[model samples]
Target: MNQIAPIRPDAARNLPQPAALRAGIGAVLDIDLDAIAANRAKLIEVAGGLDCAAVVKADAYGLGAEAVAAALARAGCDKFFVAHIDEGIALRAAVPTASIFVLHGVVPGAEGAMCAYGLIPVLSTPAQIEIWRERAARRGKNLPAALHLDTGMARLGLSEHEFYALANDPSNLAGLDLRLVLSHLAAAEEKDNPSNARQREKFEDLRKRLPKIPASLANSSGVFLGRAYHFDLLRPGAALYGIAPRADEPNPLAQVVKLSARVLRVDDLPAKTPVGYNGRYVTPAPSRIATLSLGYADGFCRALGNSRVNAGFAGQKLPIVGNVSMDMITVDASSLPPGRLREGDFVDVIGGDADSVDRIAQAAGTIGYEILTALGARFQRRHSFSNEGRLA
Candidate 1:
């Protein structure tokens, strides 16, 4: 097996250029690291004096976790979160000095690796707590860990009853150095949801019962729920990647990614001409059709194949038509200016340069997160390293 050498932040220029690799691929995912740092700045500004933690889980929501984490770390992010221990471990290698929290906790034998890698598992259940304690005892040291209490979202974390049980017995926390207490929000984005108040109150009440350690209850949206949900730290994930933390509101974060693909072919199809596989679409008139070097296999949702969802070129909306093939998608370019589009011309498909992720998501009947993380690797990635304000 060939081993890939580690690439340092300073050596980023020497790393494989996925962005320029579009020699034949035709598609490019332009990632703006500066925009990400600016997003963190926005988060910090909103956080007041509280520390801001970045959630780089799902490979920084599929924008490449290592690069993103390194950028965040430079921008003063000291803490990070990933859902699984494996994600935590991989991230630990990238940002060695930063604290990495495993939201999913440890998995039996994986306890050794978890502790060895200096990961702080969010001990949410008694089983996880017990295994973590055992790992600490075997190592003859009280290892650091975080406690997750169930405030409202019954997803993970200790229930009210179990929380109180641990509060009553200090011995349950032995061999574990509780560094922070955290909880998740069910709908902090709703803004007016009563659950936000209920969870905030519950978290405040639970903190008094538990050991005196810092507590965090907000995710991306929770930060906007005001200082009450800010707690001692703010954990934001999607917002850092340009995902709107709240629904039906203007996204405050900078657009971090722009996906564009080349026009593979263009031709005029007369009325009644069948398009793509299964004839999902038929020409309504003599329409100029363009085939993009992109499709469902590249994480473009299949449901968006023949839907109202469209692409963009030269400040014009190019409607997608026909079934989205594994490697290509056809778009109606009849609305484009005469000869404005041709073979090899690039068109913005996902974000920034054209339709926002939110708008495109509405067309696909999905959310911005689904679109961002589902982005496949076929497209070469180009990251904006400049510290300029913003492009759009």
Candidate 2:
């Protein structure tokens, strides 16, 4: 048998690179991890000597959890929070040394895996506390866990009656090393919502009843409620990933995500021509249109295309024309000079100061977290970091 000779080095050097076959057809979510570190640093500074804990729950708000956690761990973030035990275990695999706090606490049968992975559950109910305490006893030592008390959220955590019962019987906490006592803040973003102080006061009162250990009550928004809410540790989720902590106030966090879509083609329509599904929009005059390779299925909300929200490119606003389809949407590019938009040219769908994630979400009658978490898997993701500041 004769073997083929090896290709010449010069010939191999002339080979074409593998093409990004799908990147040009959808969209790209450019994630700047450096902005995340900056956000953390800002939160730490605002925390006034308190340790900051990064919340990587919801897969780091849909920006890739493992990558986000690893980047944050490198930025001196030793604490991480996840909404589920599975997320905690996965994060444990990513940053082995960091503390992974599972917000949902130990599910009844999951205690074994929880211990095996060295995961800390934020026990919220009496039964959960009892179960964790028994597990600690069975292990013949105290196990690290956090306790969550409900102040006003009325969602998770122990009710006032259950907590008082536990407080009355200190034995309930035995065999467990209580590392943190936290509460959920329902109105941290509303500066004037009297509930912030009410919850803080309630948390303070609850603290007096429990064992003296480090405690936390701050969420991403809570961190901005000032040092009183800071306590021993600050748990910031959305803010670290660039969601504005306060809704009405200016966004203090640096923008971390840039979403861009490539124009697939341009079209011209005569006056009074119908466009898009069901003809929701009709061209009043001769018009120019550019269709982008992104749509509602890609987490670019349908409300954006239908509600007259505009996309941006080189400071020019391309007003969305009609209904957003599953994988495509058309924008009115008639206002721009001819040839301004063409096939393969990228439009800044989520860029510029005006097209910030929060702004777009507001136009869609939602919040930034929804916008961030809704980011679909169709887009190409690029994660980058910088030492001096945000990565370009």
Candidate 3:
């Protein structure tokens, strides 16, 4: 058998920088790593001194988990949460010392790997509890895990009867070392919603029943529900990626991701010329149209068609016209001053001081969370960071 030779650290200096590869790409997703760290700090501040655990599930809401987790860990985020065992394993490799809690709990045969990797499972059912007990007994070792009780989410948690059984027979929790007791808030984002108080009351009741264990009852939206909602710890996901928890207030997060696409071609159209598929838009006058390299495949929704969306270029507002195609869209550049616009130049999709995730969401008839998470993976990604101080 032949063994592969290991490359020396000194040889890495000869490797080309990754950013240089994107020099010719028509589009790119610029990610701000510093914005992510600052977002974590803001979440901590909003938590009012409570320990904030970074939620890196769904690849950190599609913004790249390892990169996001590594940055957050450096910013003092010790506890992390993910939706699956694989995510836990990947995150463990990224931040070895950070405690990773698997939200989906144990799934049949995955118990051993969970223990081997030092990943804590959030047990949500009696079968999961049994599995953990049997695995711990077989290994002759106490496994760390958290118990998730269903408050009002009606998702991924033990029912009331299961909770009563666990409460009655605390020995069922034996062999398995319980670290944190948690429940999900279904409507924490809607501050005035009755479900928030109801869930909090139920969780508090459960905490009283299991007096020895520390309890967690908050998610991203729950952190804004005041100190009462902040128990032993708070897990925030979307807010860390610059998505606002509430719609009424100004977004407390900085722009962390920006999408930009280049102009593929420029065409001069006569008055009344139809553009794109279905002839959805007609030029009211002779117009100079620039075809863009972005479309629905890049996560720009088709519903955004027919809307007069603006793209910034050389301090001019270029209006989007006609239907958004699979890999292209047409923009009106007739108003662009001479020498200020040209083919191959990039247009901002999100980010910059002018265009924001909120504005994009508004134009798409959606929320900022959708706009950020829906961003596609086809574009080259660049991650950076900054410290802009806290909002007063």
Question: Number of the top candidate by lDDT?
Answer: 1
Better of 1 and 3 by TM-score: 1
Best by TM-score: 1
Mind giving the per-residue lDDT tens digits that candidate 1 earns over 238-321? 888888887688888878888998898899889999999999899989999999999888998788877467688877888888
Ranking by TM-score: 1, 2, 3
* Backbone clash count, each prediction separately: 0, 0, 3
lDDT digits (tens) for residues 1-392 of candidate 2 = 11112222123222122224364457877777767877887888777757999999998998888877877776678999999999988878778888999999997899999999999999999889989988998999999999999998899999888989888987878988888999989988898899999999999988888748788999999998888988999999989878888778898887888888889999888988888898888888999988889998998888887536778777778888889999988888888888877889878788551288888888889998999999899888776553333322
Candidate 3 runs further than 4 Å off: 1-18, 362-365, 387-392
Tell me, what's the RMSD of every candidate?
5.3, 8.7, 6.8
**lDDT score of residue 224 within candidate 1:** 87
What are the clashing pairs of model 1? Answer: none
For model 1, give the 10-residue run with minimal summed lDDT. Answer: 1-10
Candidate 1 wrong stretches, greater than 4 Å: 1-19, 386-392
Each prediction's whole-model lDDT (CA): 0.83, 0.82, 0.79
Q: Residue 141: error of model 1 in Å? A: 1.0
Better of 2 and 3 by TM-score: 2
